[model samples]
Target: MTTTDMLTGALAAAARGWHVFPLLPSTKRPARPNHRERDCTGTDPRCRAGHTGWDARATTDQTRIRRAWSSNNPSYGIGIACGPSGLVVVDLDTHKPGTEIPEPWNRFGIRTGEDVLDHLAGARGGTITPTYTVRTPSGGTHLYYTAPEGVRYGNTAGTIGWLVDTRAHGGYVVAPPTTIGSSSYVVTDDRPAAPLPLFLLDLLKPQRHTTSAAAPKRFDARTDRVPAYVASAIKGEVAKVTSAGAKQHNHRLLCAAIALGQLVAGGVLDERTAYDALTDAARVLMARGCDCTPIEVDRTIRSGFHIGSRNPRTPGTTRDNSRKAA
Candidate 1:
């Protein structure tokens, strides 16, 4: 298959549940610390003082990762993850043909799997280097060095940053700017690199951790009981309420609920309790007044549904009365 065709196939596979991130551009986010101090117990100095830190053993999620430019709070940023170890952080910003390797520990290159190995061999005085490759959602490949034992590779943000040290870590991600052709492969000289064995591939496939506290059940958005935007907001909000605290967690959801609730409060589901709950929530958020879009949020008092308990308005079904009331 052609490169675009291969990408489409990968995206189709991703849609079936493999998370995919289109290499799209995002606005520059107001810069935050490359790292945050956290208080896991909620009683530590950082936790009480509102500091943040990432736990090495903490589960890494594709949807909950965030980067410098994400709008979603504590956005689950995109990266190439392998068998419990995070490879390189993918830079979605630059799309040029050549690869951009990080400095001091300059390891990544434009070469393919086969060629990268040779380059590393020359650099390391002909020492044999082992390599592993992963197929990206865009049908590109991520090359890694199987570091010798006792070597360590990690960044300050734990699961977030793309920084890799050559002697310290056994593996590194192929930087984003690097592009591999349909027939070209990569080579590395760090160690002896080879194709992944089936046993390792089986382990590398993404699987939700059984130990993850079962995600709280969420109301179905596909049922068309809620307006599309409101349903989207609810799905987004549910993930918000339960999320472990991160940079972008609360403000957007708070704003979304306010906007949607105000829009749909006076219609068929109009009740003082639901209306008051939403209004109060909005007011609290507005008090803090972080920047967010003014979208309406409506919720059913009894059922956890956004619009109402039963079959409610679908995307195109906003009732005239509801609009008038809004």
Candidate 2:
């Protein structure tokens, strides 16, 4: 399609109140450089060099949208910023040519986007509610939903499992009619974006400890060793969360929660202690450029703590030392 056609689609999305931005011509990547070193803070001469910090660059103003598209690369693709657009897109990635199934999906026996969708549907008591679906240029799928109010969700990869990623706050997705090479993103389902389902919401919510009074007391026998163990566990989970990449924000938070939860279950730490330690670990990852928020860390820990409390670990049993912790 011509640049005019692509711009028209972008304007349509903007008309619907979705924030739009121009992507690099015919590419899914943003038209900006996101590196902190190259990041532009405001409208300076350097800022005009490239579109940096696209989350801030996304706009709904028709004049800005037109200017972006009418630039030298008028054929630029359309990118819809998720949070500003009130969108939460579930991106089910397909296996790229010559690449094996990603580790997360293979571990879960998921082979395709449809498989993940089916699993979600089954978990929700069958019959997944249909929403506006987009067929991506690379044979993947984008399932769009209206994000929940008062809850800001950022992009996440592998949090929902392998081959599944989310585009939310601080993220963007290629809009329909965008093309890369011979492939193009097309609207498969013409339905409007639907509200996120409850099951998905539960999965997405941050975990946090609510009751300090009910927190488990530290065990006397292993009191000295408890601090060391807790430190070790937190460090280990932090490493995992960090190594997983920014897209795995939720996944990383969940991993930290489970790790700290294990420590709480082992009586090495109380719920309050575990919550603080987990939060610190999450912060460490965030400082290193992970997309984690304090709220997300709290919620993840709370959720994991419940599970750990229910299945307290037996005393004297040690976790696998073979596994490297940080």
**C-alpha lDDT score of every prediction, in listed order:** 0.31, 0.67
lDDT: which candidate is best? Answer: 2
User: Which 10-residue window in model 1 sums to the lowest lDDT?
Assistant: 22-31
Model 1 lDDT tens row, 129-198: 1243334434444444332233234422211212211211222233222233332223222222332211
**Residue-wise lDDT of candidate 2 within 129-247, one digit each (tens)?**
35778998778899888886788998889777667789999889999788899988999887667666434665677542232322323222234635665556655665675466657
Off by over 4 Å in 2: 32-52, 97-109, 124-127, 206-326
Q: What TM-score do all the candidates reach, one by one?
A: 0.23, 0.57
